[model samples]
Target: MNDARDVTILGEPERSDRPARPGREGKGEIHLVHMYPREMSIYGDLGNTRCLAARIRRHGYAPVVHQHHPGDELPEQVHLLVGGGGQDSGQVTVEEDLARVGDRLRSLADDGVAMLMICGMYQLLGQTFTTVGGRQLPGLGLFDVTTLGGEERMIGPIVLSTDFGDVVGYENHSGATTRGAGQAPFGTVRHGRGNDGSDGTEGAITGHAIGSYLHGPILPANPAVADALIGWAAEASTGREFEPEPLDDEVARQARTRQIARLLG
Candidate 1:
């Protein structure tokens, strides 16, 4: 990530013009649990996990990714867990069996492992996400979101801004996430609300978990998003004030602008 090296007047001072790297080599390992990545890995949701693991590896950190298929035991020491999007029909097929893992998942959630769930996974985190087919499948309810499915699926680019920065990704989902009496929306919609039909309350976040309907497989261009998740894992591991190197760069900035334009169009 270094562009160049320069000499300073004060007896050769060192400046970190290169990108910040987390100490991941043999330092410790952060584990990622992939849930039904095959059955429901729709749109770019799978990219979320990939970007997450990559970002961690880019930094000085070591990441261990574990795929959780049917009949596999979930790790008790997972630093992060990622669940990707899927189609509603696909969701229905696995909803019951997946729900069986709810109690164990809730236990993991309670353990303070950071999680990122997109699209169908986002809908499944709620109490129930009703599909256009008039089916209301139960969710893990790890978050306080509820979805009402519709025909007009939200599929396209989108723009979102958070403490991290302006992020560009795609929106593709049929269910609308409605925060209940005391629930908070994940982030304000700058443009292209994720749930196309409704007023675009894509998903919710409870504690260290984030569920969003936006995904262009949403990453690569936005390293800050990846760093944000990595930061969460770092916070859990180091047990101290966690700070990461700035994620903004010229290449990243231009890419972000182009992505937002596609969303605006």
Candidate 2:
């Protein structure tokens, strides 16, 4: 998967034998797990969850939001997972909890669960995150990447080019990440520092799991990614294509357009 040019937009179809939970007279509901809402949402990234739920609801299928916190039991059936950035201290707070759920997360990933992880959470999805003081923290190792803390933080509006389209967001991070062998970036940087500020890359995307530093909460400004994730989740749930009804995204489009123009300026 080192070359992202050939990486499929949606990952493999679900082959899990697990039966779907019944929703309103046998309709299958999409199970969305929001990780660390209490601790990892300092950036108001919970908006991403809300945006996803709204999109799913527009499809006429219920999308249940499960907020998973430290020490809380994880849901056995998860279609998608969304997590966000936090302070270094907050990262430490969720460390043990993440370790406890590592096996389950990896299992879900293998079963084609789509995930959107940002900044602090993105670092935790990798092998390790080293602090500026040289303290090392363990990660889930789902993505073959490592983040090293730095004094010079990359903070600004960012524009990234992907095969899907140009994604815009605001990034603020000091832990520059480096992809390990066999890893592919989600996109190339067009207007801001990415990954390590030298590679021109912004995020990592592998088999339905996405790790990025972009967090203008992400979804409000980039609905395409959100829809892709939901589409993948719907497909993974029923072994069929999930065609969502079109919803007006004028506000989101306006926000994105303004951000892009400003970034260009």
Candidate 3:
């Protein structure tokens, strides 16, 4: 119920003293908004925001992170949006508040603002989510998909063949989502369950908005996908192409490789 703005420059605790890296002097700020952080950040999903903020800084841009809660106004300018998963009770808690700002979120997506919605947030961005008890929750309809809660919870490591490359993460959900004909999947599932246990599709994507169930916080090991989101946001904010400096991702690469191998083998 506390709607105060919690702003932070992720990674730089002492903003006044740290000297800017060479070539990073002129780059401005990229506003990253985290929606319902208090209610929807279960399963370490807050890591996604931290990952983006750190990477944004490493890419020579300052990440201005805004944590949005119920009754709070969204920042006037949002370069990127990140929302995480939560329990059914948590979903119910934010259901009304989510609807209140659904229009703004949909508008942002239509205008190509980059967004990443994970698990419960992903489900709520679709047309509808029917819980196991037959209760229905209305979504923002950003993704042309529908979800039905099932008895079986899909939980495990997952690998997806995506446009960005191989994306690895963990999926834990009971919602079985089915995409409409107009919806394009974020990736093809290569291992474990995705939106549904049977669909072979991992997630849904339209324009710059993406909805996925993969959570191992989903960004640390899949830097490619994270960078893609950052790139889209940067371009949309600046109205120009974004060329980020290459950061060493060897550790992430190795981590991804090991996860994939462990899952596939």
Which candidate leads the pack in TM-score? 3
Provide TM-scores for the models: 0.83, 0.88, 0.92
CA lDDT scores, all candidates in order: 0.70, 0.83, 0.87
Indicate the worst ten consecutive residues by lDDT in candidate 3: 9-18
Clashing pairs in 2: none
Worst ten in a row by lDDT for model 2: 1-10
Better of 1 and 3 by lDDT: 3
Off by over 4 Å in 1: 1-24, 196-200, 238-249, 261-265
TM-score of 1: 0.83
Residue-by-residue lDDT tens digits, candidate 3, 50-153: 78877787777777888888899999999999999998888888999999998999899989999999999999999999888888999999999999998999
lDDT tens digits by residue: candidate 2, 1-265: 2211111111223211222233421335788988998789888687788778767766655676787988889987899999999988889999999999999999998887999999999999999999888889999988999999999999988999986688998889999999987899989998999999998898898899999999888987899999999989999887888867667789888988888888887
Model 1, residue 77: C-alpha shift (Å): 1.7
* 42 Cα displacement, candidate 1 (Å): 2.1
Candidate 1 clashes between residue pairs 3 or more apart in a chain or in different chains: 22-60, 23-60, 24-60, 24-61, 44-217
